[model samples]
Target: MSGAPEDLAERPVHGVRGEPFRRLLTTWTATSVADGVRAAALPLYAAVSTRDPVSVSAVAAAEVVPWLLIALPAGALVDRMRCRGTLVAAHSFRAVVTLLLVWFVHSGQTGTFVLLGCAFLLSSAETFADSATQSLLVSAAGERELERANGRFVGAETIGVEIAGPLAAAGLFAWRPELCFAVTALAFGFAAVWILRVSPEVEPVRAAERRSMAGEIRQGAVFVLSSPGLRAVVGTVGLVALLTSAVNAIAVLFVLESLGLAPSTVPTLLVCTAAGTLVASRTTAGLSTRFGGAPVMTGALLVLAGGVAALELVRLPGAAWGAYFLMGFGAGTWNVLSSANRQRLTPGPMMGRVTSAYRVFAWGLMPLGAAAAGPLAEVTSPATVIVVAALSIAVVAGFCAPVLRRSLP
Candidate 1:
């Protein structure tokens, strides 16, 4: 079968140059803020509902498990549909879901099950939205400009999702729990409207040459497996996700119980992480261009490990802030480079499925790591689990550094 239209090739495409990217960027910023608020609110609500570490972690696990279940199918569907329309629909669905959560919270009917169900539904929608957005990004910003584009995207995400969103959610949650969901619903609706303003460019696989859904899914997976650099990227991402998921699962508990801080302090600490990420996003492209991809990637991982380890050893709040900031910087560097690298490696037609397949292998471990964290923290202490996770991350970074240095671009 023929590839996507020449317009959809790796070269800069018409119609998506100026306005579309701005609209997409605006949509992404809105969605990121909403997602950040929800991310903070859900775990905080769970912790307030019940102090059981297992139960609390379960809520975090629910947010990401959909990636394991539906990411591949979602990616395939995105490839078959108009990305702009898909984004619109996904954002609309998320808005409705957030509204439902608002109603549930207002009615005082929320439980762990309800929280889990809502988190899962939201994430399921996100699976499609994220794939569509990434596909759209490729069209908007061609391969030659991917690093710069991704850096901007990552910077906005860090600011909205990690910094501004979380800070607002914490204040809202503290004042009135339902307010958090209400703001999130509004953000999603705003995003849906703004995304509609993006150019209605269609880049789906041609109907005449379209393969079966299963075939398409396998094709994307196969493409990723066939490339050594992609293989290394996926492996490293998976390991990093696994370890980081554990830390995220228990982060609230660690802040509240371990550090003996107020719930409000959670977002304050996250801001530190976001600060680091913002710096990394701005610098990752330049660093990679100068030093090479492998060293930057490996060094980022080491930095993350150091941050995680510091969190366990230090007992002071200032120390925790610094550690989280370091972790965010490391994570930010890895995320921006990896995303740009993946987009550069994959063909335009296969972008959706390949991105989804990449996530299925890498992010699919998030739930497992989150679930395991609860039990481990229950048996041991949260600090112990975090330290162990940090060590594992270090080990992976050390082991993969040489291999990636040799393999990656």
Candidate 2:
């Protein structure tokens, strides 16, 4: 189904300056900060609690496994529900879960199982929030300003999740684990409040047009599969995510054991990566516009591969920092361009479902990659697994290049 002509015409001509877009950005930034805290805290806590690679990686796996389990259903639900309400509810749920996690940590019940359960629940909430947020973005910024809006969104995410969030997590986790979680809960609460202020230009689906959940889901899947461009983007992204997860699952371990960095320094190292993402957030749109989306994306993957390979081969703290920065830059560029392209291609009513379907293929493999990393690292080394992942990403880039060149604008 097509969007209303009036809605299309009424989109802000001034880029992402609309009130709805501002509120959505605020909401996303708050949520990103909360996510960053939990993300950094979990692995750090797990590493200290148990040195077992499998156990540590299991925590990482639990967080992303929801993408596989609930992303599609959540997307369908988001399409059916109001985006603002869905976001509010999701954030509220996350706040409650985080409070529970705080209680667990305070009670000295910081077991692997407890961490895994909390991570899974929190990530499940994220699935809904993310799907609804993407749908909301379309309404807030419209198609014309999607690249700029997404660039700002990615910048917020980089700063909040990667920079501010991790830094805060490091300090708070160092001070008291429960304190870190308490802060995360507060962030989620704030996000709920912020999103409530957004007044998006929503066009509700008519009752006559509504279908069964399964049918809607199938329709989304069919749409994604039928488009060769979407298929190439989805498949390439899925492969990249799989390999990247393997590298990330063991990253903390690599820093602590291989580089001999202190726990406090870990977040600082992460900040370097965030710095690169911040740079890309400002530059990706122009780069894509000048060079075309396909070439930029393909080159970004190559840059990421180079970063990982450098990290493996060099093994110095300075080199590690630069490598991560390069990796983040490449990732940020690819993410912004890919998301804008997808949003541009999709119909308004189908946005949520299509986004979810895309993610089911793109991000669903993350758990498998993360889960395997620990065992693989145990057998060889974190460095070995990382380099292998880098090589795999490079290979996928080569195979997907021609399709991306042909399909992406």
Evaluated with TM-score, which candidate comes out highest?
A: 2
Clashing pairs in 2: none
After superposition of all CA atoms, the RMSD between model 2 and the true structure is: 4.8
Over the full model, what C-alpha lDDT does candidate 1 score relative to the true structure? Answer: 0.87
Q: Candidate 1 at 86: error in angstroms?
A: 0.5
Off by over 4 Å in 1: 1-17, 43-61, 101-117, 173-176, 200-202, 247-267, 312-317, 371-391
CA lDDT, every model vs. true structure: 0.87, 0.86
Per-residue lDDT over 199-248 for candidate 2, one digit per residue giving the tens place of the 0 to 100 score? 75455456689899899889889989888888889989988999998999
Per-prediction TM-score: 0.83, 0.84
lDDT minimum window of 10 residues, candidate 2: 198-207
Candidate 1 backbone clash number = 0
Candidate 1: tens digits of C-alpha lDDT, residues 285-359: 899889987899899999999999998787774898999899999999999888988988888778889999999
